[model samples]
Target: MTLAKGPLFLLVLTALALTSCQSDDKPPQPRFTSDASGSQVGKASQREGQYFIEFRSRYALTYGHTYAVFGRLNKAGGMINPQVAGLAPASADAAPYVLGHFIPVPATTGATDGDLEEAYRSASWRILLTEAEYNKTVAFIRQLQAKSKLWQATVDNCNNFVGEIAGSMGYKTPSIWLRPQEFITKLREMNT
Candidate 1:
């Protein structure tokens, strides 16, 4: 008995079609670091030796007023004093009623490393990220600077800025109503 050529061709074509439609069943291969240790070193640990964000706040002369500063630790280390950013009154008349839309400013202006010591009393929270994650976080911060109004004192102020940056680094946002000191405590609690 001879099999017909048409039937044989149809069977082969059907087999090929079914094979093409089938899903791949192989498990995904695992990714590993170049070290061969099977352990991954985080980005913060890799580049900076460490990485951190600090919040510094002090009570102003006005009873209800508090001035807060936020900064990232320099890759050189905290001993070098991180570059801090904050909001200050636009003018002397702007004081006391500091709750206006002020622009974001570098709190420490033209100050030497020696000066930063006396200028800020701060508490910091540290984090670790992969190199890719660090780059992504930086890009997010740059975008924020470009688009966000960065109005100080009024409603969206320094605390909001820091909180947003921290959140990008996988941190939870503290209560908007919390004072700087209280916010620091909350950050520590969440990070720890």
Candidate 2:
């Protein structure tokens, strides 16, 4: 059957997409335990203080969120001292999510509530970092966070945020408008 197109259709489609991403009724874990690669403590870096960055896209269907995760690595190449960040509207209310569809809204960077929740990750790309690279990347993230004041869903949205971070890390990013998962998957494909 052919599909209908209009405001109501869009609303219903969005509702279905969002609803499909709801958790499987299982409660989230107490704390984030692993990076997107799956190993947290097992893949320590070649040296102490070495670091890693992983760009991730979490579920919400086409509206899924994208963010970056970084951390120190122990001598064994496993991740440690993990940190996360992303660009998003300052509020978690439906208003921002919806309003962002039209205009820019006050935004914040640094980890939001779901950044550490491993269960939401639908796509990710990771890279090991040297001490120098780690320091620079972290500094860049801070600067980006400080300067980024607004988030517009169709403009400088989450994928743009993650893509900016990825670009700083020297990875070629896919188009920012792609769904979070597709953007992330393309990121890995282009880089690796």
Candidate 3:
């Protein structure tokens, strides 16, 4: 049968529009995954820029404590001493840097001052760092390898190695979910 021009033209136009719209076969999914890989924690030390502290043990996503730690580091100028203000607050941000982030060495924590070396050696491995986190930590040690010259500026290993370096430089607090690109902004700021 012969078709009318107006209806036929409308049908063809509609079909073309539909085909083009359907090209994007699947609607975009959230791409959510429980895995931490590909996330910021996975790319630790990809650049020699700022460092970041992962939760000593990956905390539940719902937990606010991890963010508290991040905030403490950011606010404390990168060194949250465990003896800060009577360990004032119970939350990670308020307490002296103990628990997950650091070992409560009497020296580091300002409890006793006999031999810090022994304390560090004993406490270093006590924190629950992952293989990747541990590796970055080791690299941090090598970076801060004790200097002989007392006059030379001390390499801030506490800042660099413990992942507080980023906080020290200043970008934003609680950047636990910060991407590499985001971390770089702090690096640039510190360098400049």
Candidate 4:
């Protein structure tokens, strides 16, 4: 027995329709968690005193146009003391700068008051994270550091490092083409 062309076409169309309907029933998964409990899988949150992830950018003349670029970018290492979200106290002598670097030398570094002052001078943007979320993010960065090889100027730079940290905090990773400035803008738009 042979099947007719019209009947075969109908059967194929029916199968496609059923598959599409099945996929539609499932809800889309969340990229990050905003729950205060911090129990949700793949979500990060803190209990109190906002946890901020900042992106600091520096500009340099590239080619002929002087575009806004990231020369030496930094992330505000977890919690800067005195319980301030974005502000770093100038008089706080013991304030340690917890920063991650792309260079092969341990993926992370610490700076004191003077270094922090210079680094914070660049245009910076902040996003709040919870204490639990902050701990998880720090762990993730440590793991990446241990496994990662030396940083490549073009391949694995500071922007890529920040992108990974952002991803851990449940933020969507921006396109590779986006510079630090553009990535921060996109992050602020999505977060706010």
Model 2: runs farther than 4 Å from truth? Answer: 1-48, 75-78
Judge candidate 2 against the unseen true structure and give its global Cα lDDT, from 0 to 1.
Answer: 0.70
Clashes of each: 1, 6, 1, 4
For model 3, the local distance difference test gives 0.25
| Per-model TM against the reference | 0.49, 0.73, 0.19, 0.44
Q: What is the C-alpha RMSD of each candidate to the true structure, in Å?
A: 23.0, 7.2, 22.8, 18.0
Candidate No. with top TM-score: 2
Model 4 agreement with the true structure over 35-122: per-residue lDDT tens digits? 3232232213333345544444333221000011111112423333421111111223222211111112222222213223433333
Model 1 segments more than 4 A misplaced: 1-51, 55-81, 86-115, 150-154
TM-score of 2: 0.73
Report the lDDT tens digits of candidate 1 across residue range 61-127.
3211222223333454343344444433334464433434233432321112221343233333344
Candidate 3: 10-residue stretch with minimal lDDT: 148-157
lDDT tens digits, residue span 1-192, model 3:
356887776566445433322321112111111112222222322323222332211111111111102111223223233211011112334233222222222112111221122221111111223456545644443343332111100121122222342233232333222222222233333323
The parts of candidate 3 lying over 4 Å away from their true place are 1-128, 151-192
Q: Model 1 scores what on Cα lDDT?
A: 0.42
By lDDT, the better pick of 1 and 2 is: 2
